[model samples]
Target: MSKVVLVTGGSSGIGKAIGEFLQNKGFVVYGTSRNPSNYKNSKFPLVALDVTKSNSITQCVEEVLIRTSRIDVLINNAGAGITGPIEEIPEEEIKRNFETNFFGPLNVIKAILPEMRKQGSGIIINITSIAGYMGLPYRGIYSASKGALELITEAYRMELKPFNIDMVNVAPGDFATNIASGRYHAPAKEDSPYHPNYANVLKMMDDHVDDGSDPKQMAQAILRIINTSKPKIHYKVGAFMQKFSIVLKRILPDNIYEKLLMNHYKL
Candidate 1:
């Protein structure tokens, strides 16, 4: 039988690209969107799912299993971003950011792991970000969400090793996508102290995404990862400079790295 693949947030952007790529590779792909009807014309079948809600995740998995009988791979790609100064970002906004980016994936994983454990084999891939390594200016909540997922992925890898399950964290620096249009902007008052720099830095971040590598490249990298019998625990996909930035962080002192980051973002 062909392998079954489940991808969350598969309606558009990187998730959609990965779904299409894997479908073409002959896997039985079931992509999820809160409103599957939105992607009725998509190549792969769309399953209704809202990762933030536990019941929605359970139902989505059940629906997929009814058709495919088994799931061989699960890709946690659903996420959202909140950009603004930390002080200006409301508590609810931070919680919502984590809801979609971190907790959403956790909910899906919990729902799927039972079957994976039953089969004694499966692969789980968490789509993280380069920003996860360190908090980013004007996007602290978004970075924190991804960082939380990264750490969860690390722990799950070790715990699931004996169950014949594999876990991976795919950290993309930036990918040309519609993410900018989807991101939430923290309310900034006219008299807010960080107003001047917040607007410029947020625009800079969006522009960085616009100039990022092709999503198809990220899709291809994911395919390669899926094919590996024993994939690495972590993978970085992006430009040389972006990937090197992570390396620099590891080798540089905190004071120096902080300066480099501030300069690079023009903060």
Candidate 2:
């Protein structure tokens, strides 16, 4: 039987691309959306899911298992983005971002672990961000959330190793998707001290997404990981600079790397 793949947040963007690509490749693909009815034209079946909600996560996993009887691959792609000066962003919004980007994926994995354990095999891929490798101005909250997930996956990999279960992180740079429309932007108040820089950075961020690489590239990277016999713990997909930025951070001194980032963002 073809592998059964479950992609959270798969209704659109990178998740949608992965689902469609996998389905075309002969895998049984199921995507998730908060409102399944909204995606009547989605290429693969979309099940209802609100990643931040535990009950919704449970229901979605159960529904998929009922139909497929097994889930060979779990793609924790559901995430939310937030942008604002760390001090300016409301505490609640930061928490909410973590709830979606971090906790949500954990819950989904929890729900699916038992079945995968029963089958004696499974692969879990967490869709993180290149920004997670380093903090970016006005996007601290988003960076922190995704970065936390990256670390968590490292721990999970070792724990699941004996069970023959694999977990990896696939961090993508900007991709042309509707993520900008869905992201929560802390209002840039004209009277606030950060208004000018924050506003400029926000615009730059959106433009980057608008000009980002095709989501299909992410899908292809994912397909490669799924097919590999022993996948690496972390994979990055993006332009040369974006992926290289991570390498530079590792080799460069703290102050120098910070300077490079400041120059890039014009901060």
Candidate 3:
């Protein structure tokens, strides 16, 4: 039987691309959306899911297992975006971002582990962000949440090794998607100290997405990883500079790397 793949937040964006690509490649693909009815035209089946809610996660996983009897791959792609100066972003918004980007994926993994363990095999891929590798101005909250997931996956890999289960992180740079429409932007108040800079950064961030690479590239990269027998713990898919930025951070002096990012963002 073809592998059964579950992609969270798969109704659109990177998740959608991955789901469609996998389905075309002969895998049984199931994507999740908060309101599955909204995606009646989705290429693959979409089950209702609100990653931040435990009951929703449980129901979605159970429903998939009931139909497929096994889940060979779990893609933790559901995430939220947040942008604002760390101090300016409301505490609740920060918590909510974590609830979606970090806790949500972690919980989904928890929900699926038992079934995978029973099957004696599985691969879990966490869709993180290139932004997670560094603290970007105005996007600090998003960076922190995704970065935390990256670390958590590293820990999970070791713990799941004996069970023949694999976990990996795939960090993508900007991709042309509707993510900006849903992203939480802490209002850039004209009276506030960060007014103009924050506003400019927000615009720049949106433009980057507007000009980003095709989401299909991400789908292809994921397909390659899924086919590998021993996948690496982390894989990054994006433009040269975006992937290179992570390398720069590792070798460049801390102050120098920070300067580069500041210059890039024109901060």
Candidate 4:
């Protein structure tokens, strides 16, 4: 039998690519989105799921159970972004960012844990980003959301180990996606601090996403995880050059690492 898998935000971009890839591999793919979707055709089921809302998430899971009666894998990929200076960002926007990026996965994890625990077998993959590891200008809120998610994924992995359920985190570097285009673009509020450098920071973010790696490559990485029997708990994907930043952080002096970032990102 094909393994049953559930993916959130599978309507487009990386999620969409993943759903297509897994379907071709013969897995029963159920992609979740907040809004109704018909893009995946009749072969794959595209279920409506809004991670921010408990009721919405619960209903989606129930629907999946009603259809397939089992879930072997879960991928929490639904997320949003917020861009602006840390000081100028509104408190409510930060909360919203966390709601979709962090708590969204938390809710999905909660919904699936019971079933996975009872079965004593399952894998959960959380789609995070390099921003989760290192903070960057104009993306404080987005980075914080991913950083929180990284810690949450690690803690959950430890907690679920006893249940025989595995948790994995996939942190990808810049990927070409509509997410960058739709970032919550809030310039410095009038009379707020950080008026200077706001445009430059946002511009850099824009440029990175515009020319980043293709979404299909990320789909391939997700496929690699699902097909592997002993799937790794964490997978980092991106240009090998990204390793330089990781190395700089680990080996270079603090001042030197900071300078490297400034020189690299043109900050």
Candidate 5:
């Protein structure tokens, strides 16, 4: 029997690509979305899942387990984007961002880790973002949420090692996706003072997405990770520039790195 794989946010974008690729590779792939009805003509099964809700997550796992009898890999790919000047971003907006980007994956982990532990083997992949490594100009909240998820992935990797389970964080740079359509824009009003700068930064972000790496490439990277016997704790998927940015952030002087980031976004 092929290994069963469960992926959240699989109705579109990177999640959808991963599901399709895994299914083509002969993995028993089950993909989830908030609305399954619209995920038409899918090659893999589409299940309804709301990762932010504990009951919803639990039920989704149960549904996958009922159909496949086992879930060998669980990929948490559901996330939301937020943009605005940090000082102007509302507290509720920040919380909402964390609810989707950070807590969502953690909730899924809580729901599925027990079963993996019982089986004594499994893999958990949390789809984070390259921005998680450093705070971005207008995407501070989104960055923080992903950064928190990445740290959690690291902690779980150590904690779950003994159980023969692995947890990894895949941090992709900007990817060709519709995530910008649903992104939360904290109140940067026309006369809000930070408008022009924030608007410029938003435009820069949009351009990056327009020129972002292909999601299919990310899917292939994920397949490589899945095929490995002992996958690395962190996977960075994107163009050389994007991957190099992470390395630059680590080795460069703090002020110099911040300057480069600010220049890149024209902040």
Candidate 6:
């Protein structure tokens, strides 16, 4: 039987690259999007899924079930960003971020675990972020969402270890993707709590994304892991700064790291 892989948010960006890479390796790939019309790429089995909605997830899983009868792997690569100060973002925005980034994967796991448990072998790959490690300025909500994911992944790995289901997290520090552009921007409040500082941090994030790692390289790395018999529970990919992001969090004093990050984004 051919192994099957389903990649959420696989219409474009990193998710699309993962879809393409896995297809070349001979996996039956199913890439998902909210609206089939919104996706321009029709290379794979493009299924209908909106991570924010449980009904949508159920529908997509149903389609996968009818055809494949078993899913070998699930890549939860669907997520959005909200770039703004923690105190400034509205409660609604935070809730929505959690819904899509945190609960969405949880919902998918719920729908698919029965199948995975029955099979006695399956993999759940989550594309988390380096932000899950250290909170970034103007990204409290986004960071929190991914942090929640890290915890969720860890817990699942521990509990499911004996069940033959593997849980993995790919934490990318900075990547060239449409993430910044796709972020949900709440309308700015004029002369409000967060203005120029918010604007500066957003710009810094944009600058990094533009010069970040090549999506193709990241895709290849994922393929390498897929081909391996034993894959690590977590893989962190980035340039020097990403290594620094973690090291600084550990060795450096909190005060020094705060000043360093602030200086990195200083106007």
Task: Provide C-alpha RMSD values for all models, in order.
Answer: 0.9, 0.6, 0.6, 2.0, 1.1, 1.6
Q: Candidate 6 has what TM-score?
A: 0.94
Query: How do the residues 93-158 of candidate 2 rate in per-residue lDDT, one tens digit apiece?
Result: 999999999999999999999999999999999999999999899999899999999999999999
TM-score list, all predictions: 0.98, 0.99, 0.99, 0.93, 0.97, 0.94
Task: Give the per-residue lDDT of model 6 (tens digit) for 88-135.
Answer: 678898999999999999999989999999999988889888898887
Clashing pairs for model 1 are none
Candidate 4 — worst ten consecutive residues by lDDT sum? 35-44
Worst 10 residues of 6 by lDDT: 185-194
Predictions in order: lDDT: 0.91, 0.95, 0.96, 0.83, 0.90, 0.85
Which parts of model 4 are misplaced by more than 4 Å?
37-43, 188-196
Find the number of clashing residue pairs for candidate 3.
0
Error of 6 at 82 (Å): 0.4
Off by over 4 Å in 3: none
Give a tens-digit lDDT track for model 3, residues 30-80.
999999999889999999999999999999999999999999999999999
Clashing pairs in 3: none
Residue 6 displacement (Å), model 5: 0.5
lDDT of 4 at 40: 45
lDDT of 4 at 149: 89
lDDT of 5 by residue, 76-167 (tens): 99999999988898889898889999888888988898899888899999999999999988888999999999998888899998999988
Error of 6 at 189 (Å): 4.8
* Better TM-score candidate (2, 5): 2
